[model samples]
Target: MFKRLILFILLASCFLGHAQTYQVEKGNSKYNAFAFIEAQKIYLKLVEDGYATTEILSKLGDTYYFNDDLKQAQKWYAKLFAHYENQVTPEYFFRYAQSLKAVNKYEESDVYMVKFNTSKGFDARSKMLEEDSNYLQMIDFQSGRFEIANAKEINSSKADFGPAFYASNNQVVYATARESGSVLRERHTWNNQPFLQLYTADADENGVLGNPKPMSNLINTKYHESTPVFTNDGRTMYFTRNNYDNGVYLQDKTGTNKLKIFRSYKNKGKWSKPEQLPFNSDEYSVAHPTLSPDGKKLYFSSDMPGSIGYDLENEFTRSDIWVVDILADGAFGAPRNLKDINTPGRETFPFISKTNTLYFSSSGHQGLGGLDVFTSSISPSGSMGKVVNIGKPINTTYDDFGFIINDDTQTGYFSSNRPGGAGDDDIYTFLQLEDLREECEVHVVGNVTDHKTGDPIKDATLVLFDMNNNKIDQQITGDNATYTFRLDCDQSYILRVVKEDYTSNEEVITTPTSSGLMRTSLEIEINRIPVADCDDIGPLLDIQHIYFDFDKFNIRTDAGYALLKIKAFMELYPQVSIEIRSHTDSRAPDQYNELLSEKRAQSTRDWLISKGIDASRLTAKGFGERRLLNTCANGVACSSDEHQLNRRSEFIVSGFGEFKDCD
Candidate 1:
């Protein structure tokens, strides 16, 4: 089982001494030792001899469940529910639901999950299922982010997993239970296979691995040693091993040897004697070490104290990913639980990629079934973002874990125990087609400043609009006078910055097509509105001169452009009121010109009112021949351009006492 990395035996009282037969007790001994294969044999023989109990049926279901044989597990679980449904606990309901899901009996799986939820209140796993009832559809929709295949050249018929990149030599180091040339190798009672040992193999440009060989004797032992992670410089290694030291294997008070992480340094072209990390405890297991890309932090899975979902009676119920800061003095800070990433189920085999993505395997989060691979982004300040499933075929209805990747090449390796593998757990190489984090986003970041003073302007609002003029996002500048909007890459956006008493600024920018934290910096500078006295008639808001056809009072298309600016200015300064004054040249009759001027002014006011401006904020007045700018008076011979000046509109500021001060 995948739990072999840090084995835990959760024995029931029936497995202790309550068995009615000697043969059943013998089976119980094997089961207690995690030898599920041997225990299954004895349990199957008893069932064929017409001997079965609730304990025997439950143990049979779990034996297949732990061995990754979900079909058989489902069969036994069905029998358990049929004969002793009321006798089993909620844990069995969860396991049976998972097994049913593995066989694609989703409807039946949901029935047991609901039953499990009814029995177990406030369980995060059940809540996740309830929230994402369409999880299978979601998984199918997000599939095919990776192209994966088994690494056949280095795989054996036994378990081969936990691959780590040895970048210094362009090789990959992994763990395996394959036989060495040694004639007398001890087998682990848990699986009846030789203990896992470290092995290195060369990986080519395409990430194909071959030419496997055992690692140094100092690193490997007759006991278990696996899951090695090398530092960026490849001068140091952190690996998992049983609690063995000073030429002696050690066990805790419970008579069980727990796993511990050991660090080995490379000096003079040889690996130094490994030393156990200070955080490892004999009472709890700590294994599967991974390092941050910068090598300033170490992450590993453990069931130590304070681990989420840690049970004192059965510590194997769950394990969480924990991290510790690698200090400058080569020591470690206190470990912190990744509370955001861990759930009430097992979360193990954490690997941080070059892009600061934390990839791990977990049965806690919503997945297809079993432990599925998941990824979460790490912020610059070391906070965790949303956790996302890497999706199929990188994940399946079986244990898929130990994911590692190279951001530069977009290729990587992971381990899975899905069917069609050459071993119980085989390492597979994959080419990532897309990032496992959220979609391709570009951070649109910039500062808003005063145009004249060149000083940052806080409290400025920036509104983003897409090409279709749809509002996308909005941000307000803080004390730093900076605004950031995360937008899709390779798209054009219009960022409009608006501040009180300042002219609004707009900038159209196109983001780069490349991915991964791309940023477009734009600094917007806005000018303060000029001070104007009451009753002043002028184009003070930088609006263009309004013009119209001869003797026509209708608002023309060209005039609409200037009116739109007036509408925007009115919206910006809600307290300002303006009077639209219209004038005409002396060519028309005096009474006709007065009527035409009034019509023009009324049309302008009506247009603004139609655009959602309050009627009280505007007034229309006809100043026919009274406020002519040029010398185009009555009966005077003048150029048409000179008369055109008179046939224009003036926006008189009637009420703006609030903006009296220029500053």
Candidate 2:
């Protein structure tokens, strides 16, 4: 389930050529054979006998680290760093940092991260840490997007992971280390468990798996076999297995059996012999295969020669995701490393959804801890988009990987080695409550038109402001009277349109709270400044109504829009003085209503003054139930709408004597 298992397998080969004492050589042989549990026992015995060298300490730490025993890994790594800090390489510092995070010692982990950054120059993980010091808060913001549950029915008391959908039969195929009843069964010393074998289980629409059964022997081999991906038709399959050919297990000169991908076909309900993929090599690893929606591309994790993020000591210390084109003639094109998606740590178990979104597990990207799941958009031309962590509940301090999903159902499964599972690794089903992408944007588009004739008003200036009245963006309407602005989702904004001869208009709009691209269209209308007598004293702005809450005086977003209109009119007639009159309904006591209305009026006057209107030009007054616009007065029971009519604010022209023009 974790890519480190593969990485350790590769690292074991590098240690084979070194010379050591008899006891250390015996422990190294066990470690080289993917036997971490036995290797741990041997190394511990060596230390117990007073032979604790740096090599023994380093291998002791790595054995536990690769086995997901981070607590034990942290203990030995602490010893390794305490005595041999200057002697060990930078990777030990990085590994110690990762192990420290598993125990929630983030401050201690950060210290080692600083050391790793100082030594491992140009590593993206260090740069990410520098840029997002509060990365934990960012990951927490993306939590609760998924509801997850363990698939209990198909699980056993062993390692079971790498779930893939066989769409044609509504079955799930996965790898498990459960024992099969065979006298000659061979066990992998890696975890002291039986070799992995592929199994199938019937899955319901809700992803509940049952009736588990072993897959055909042709596809399941005596050596490790896992991580199978199927094409749409289900006749063709690609899976990972130990390098075996013609009934013999194959290994390179170092005597380490590497993993390779193999393709098989089904005919008449039987699977043909799997052929090793052309890209597989005797020197490196290729595993965890996934197919694109069109079945024309194959994605897998590899630690091959061309993989990025090679440390000074070893070239295969990390794994990366690679893609190969499925040629029309049923052959594979050369594999291309996903440069944009790779980093200095492991990236593996890639799953491509129907929407061209790539979901994979990574230790290279910023996350809560060990291999966390992340998503990136894959363009039609195979370019990668920004990578985002598919945050927690799906990911934890332990390894989480092998993610797959059906976008339409918003349901999927992923593997995790976190606590409370029936096995070392288990598959969990989840319903995604939100999209994995972190950014959500809404586009506001509208047109300006004449209020009377309903004609397009060109050359109008449109300004956008947030709820706090801070200017965000501005633009001028073109000949078509259209304007647009991009804004964040689930926020309220005010759009003000103005022209030289037309009365300015303001409209309040709120965007939707959903993910992805959204659009809102509007048609705003404004009228030319009206002509009036010099002594005219009445409401000048044609606002429908500006209503406050039941007893509150603070300005609401809608009320702010109306108030901006009044401010604009005052700017037009600089010498005009206006009164901001506020009213209250007859529900409260008369004295209480009068005081509340006074506060409302003062709030409106203060708001206008804040917008640069001269205080001497504006005055505020409160009208209690004494001035009723309708028949809803004291002792009268009326509908809510009738009472709402009285809860209003109006801007009236009190004096215009300074303006001599009377048109």
Candidate 3:
């Protein structure tokens, strides 16, 4: 629609008419009717009078195109092009090329497209078509004329949008503009009166939805509220809501709209009243909040300040991709802009897959018309990568957005206004074809065995936590006394091992933000405390472990509580530099492990470097696991634990960075 408005304005300014001018009467009531026919009549008359202008010719040509009168559309446009030749704007080339292609004048269409004035489209389009014969598979998807969804009435509701599903509970919560419940609050941003309010429906285990119910007052305020995404545990609700400076509005008598995120807590069978999320960027608008399956990373759509290469005044219309790390304390890191995923065009409505793949809506990408859905994978460490368009059958020349997926089942929901809808913009269910076998995830497998009995603990939950208490990802140890988590290479996660019988254990698992090896393996051990001796000073209690990379001691997320201890150790004992030692399993090359170990040790040292640890006092050593505490060596067929011991990293007290020898 915005594009249509812009095109209308361009037509008005660039097209000039003849003596027999045609004015679309305000109350003509023929805008989409024979409006173009009438315009063509007037334009031909003007041409006969020798009063036709290039602008008039183009507008009349556009009218023909809109009316599906392609032959005439081509005739007028081609005449205009012949007169202007290479002096035409990119708009002219695009419009005329489209018209030419429509009239089966491929050669002429190529000529005009070759005359395109800008490199942006030419470059992107060529790259897209260079390798793939199928336009749908030519590029990866995120949005714009790819990705599709069906729009239909899920209930008797007139309008439904802002939909979210609880993959575990099989329930749905969405914002609807239709009158609902006993509430009649103003909808504001949505065309005013009770524009949007949260509604929930019972989506059974198979994702089939039942009767709709308005969300509680605790979650839906008088103002517009919608787009509720569930935490994996289903204990918290995060969504978008607009706020008016109610206090200020009461005093200043000025009502201005500001949108922000709000969260609600579920407790004892009731929901806590929604409250504003912290660290909001008041400088820019924030809306459409989505969470990662693990609940540690939050993916939201915002027009927050980070958008580069574009501005708000013109693009209020345009939004960029923004994300923040959910810290251990649940506070967010400075929300960062994913410039790589954003375009000069608008980007919005982000949905993150359990695999950490990001699906978003965009009007800027080469789209059909209104908006399209696109996808990109997030690095295990949470860095976003290039997007792929979800091509045809999923996208059309209409608004297709609000994509939500339950990747595990290959099923999801989206919003679309395609034909056969109950009304304007209905929700559609999609079952993505799973025929393409994607790369298998590498797993860190082992057991949370009791340190004393060496027996696997049953019913223990192995939760992965980041520095921010936000759960990065979680996998419960299976009944087999073994737990497995599949993570792509390059993820830094700290796992928390917990059981009711004993103190919790901690282990480190580090993956680079990018995979360095084709495969990696890990084993985590949890030492159990005697259930009777509750006061045991077991080292397994609430330990925080941080790991480093081989031969490079930068903080690589690996197993255990020592890293948290390191952080606390540094906080308690500031001005300290520690010697970090990296060892290996000995079966490998000695020099390789030694240097790798040294580098790995320094990685931890550097993690502390910015934490006020004096660099001069910090020393890194690579033992290559040469002096093993057990009988494991580079060539030994040792037990897994022996192998684990050989790969251990430890630190000793050092002076500080400044006291060390100058490089």
C-alpha root-mean-square deviation, each candidate: 20.2, 21.8, 27.9
Candidate 2 global lDDT: 0.83
Off by over 4 Å in 3: 1-157, 181-194, 245-256, 281-283, 312-317, 435-663
Single out the weakest 10-residue window by summed lDDT for candidate 2. 531-540
Candidate 2 error regions (>4 Å): 1-21, 182-184, 440-663
Residue lDDT tens for model 1, 288-363:
9999989999999998889886865442457899999999999999999999999878899999988888999998
For residue 91, model 2's alpha carbon misses the true position, in angstroms, by 0.6
How do the predictions measure up, each by TM-score? 0.63, 0.63, 0.47
Model 2: per-residue Cα lDDT over 1-663, one tens digit each: 579998887788555434236769899888877689998998998888777788899899999888877778999998888888888877888889999988888767866776788786656777656544446755786888999999888877888999998966389999998875765458887778788999999989787888888999998878999999999999999999999877998887778889999999999999999999999989788999999999999999998878885554752368899999999999889999999989878999999999999999998787767889999999988899877787889988888998999888888888988889997899898999988645676656667888777788878898899989999988776545666566788999988888887778888888888643333434445443563534323245668667888888999999998888888878877867777778999998999999999999999999999999999888788987778899898889999888999998776666664323222
Model 1 alpha-carbon drift over 4 Å, by segment: 1-20, 182-184, 313-315, 437-663
For lDDT, candidate 1 versus 3, the one ahead is 1
What is residue 50's positional error in candidate 2, in angstroms? 3.9
Task: Give every collision pair in model 1.
Answer: none
